[model samples]
Target: MSPSLTFRPPTTDDAALLLAWRRLPEIAAQSFSDVPDDIDRQRAWIERSNARADYVHRIIQVDGVDVGYGSITVTHAEWRIGTIGVYMGDRRGRTGIGALNFAPMLNHCFHTLGLRKLVNQIFDSNPRVLKGQALLGYRHVGVLKDHALKDGTPRDVHLFEMRAADWAAVRHRFGLFRDMDANVTG
Candidate 1:
């Protein structure tokens, strides 16, 4: 059986743990923001992010142990569109998990947050993540050619999107619901 997963709002107390994960060579390579080298800056950034109305950041825990992080930032409040990002900081938690870790975040964006659309961008080099995106029902929208410079070379970015209208099918395909589907139908 898969380990149970939970998520909670991240606080300044998490800054150190989050930063250590962010500093991991593999994790830092994929991040858009240059990982901060200082703990104080990380704490301050977490404080600022938590204060923002348009952003929701959470720490992902597996069986009560923090293992990852996820966030959704509303990019267009008028249109109810947002961008979502997630990474598993603890390698052990990532084993056999694939895209399943994103279930709660996806549901939150479409249902609780009432977001009309959610966007994601992945580097072309990361085929593993690209496959996971497909598993999660994200449709490839476009590619930004050489959009980001990584390790001194420009790299393409693939853009994917999930619409609220498509969430029902996705939720059903993945069996992410316990009793919510009945509520929706009834």
Candidate 2:
């Protein structure tokens, strides 16, 4: 059988798992946030995040094994805008499987959540993600020089945004099509 990607809400029980992924040297280097080492702190963060109405976090699994995480933080509710990011923790699952997570993520942000636009920020050091985002139809907005610090050195952050209309046009290439009645938001 072929592998499948799935997502579920993350709970405090996942603190250790998430912390381990965040602490991986490669993952830590690419992350804008500091690598968290404490389980209690991670648990607290999960708790706080789970309680927030504007934050959506998911633990990504491949055939039942947790391998990554994804999140969308609604930055401007009125404008239906949110910032999205994802990272894979399992090295075994990193062989192009991470890209599969993007479609569902985009579907959740644009289709399920009724978000009009989704913003993605990537560190200049991560060319792989930069290229993938471009190929997925995200338009480059601008670069924020010295936008973040990595290993004590300031780095640039490339901003990309995808409008619902833009995704509607290209999502089929990713095998994601629009569902006429799936986007109704109350």
Q: List the residue pairs that clash in candidate 2.
A: none
Clashes of each: 0, 0
Model 2 spans > 4 angstroms off: 177-186
Please report the TM-score between candidate 1 and the true structure.
Answer: 0.91
Error of 1 at 114 (Å): 0.5
lDDT for residue 58 in candidate 1, whole number 0-100 = 87
Q: Which ten residues in a row have the lowest lDDT in candidate 2?
A: 177-186
Highest-scoring model, lDDT: 2
User: Could you estimate the TM-score for every candidate?
Assistant: 0.91, 0.90
Q: Cα RMSD (Å) per model?
A: 3.0, 3.1
lDDT of 2 by residue, 121-148 (tens): 8999899899999888899999999988
- Candidate-wise lDDT, in order: 0.81, 0.83
lDDT of 1 by residue, 57-122 (tens): 888877778889889899999999998888888875687555666777778787777888988989
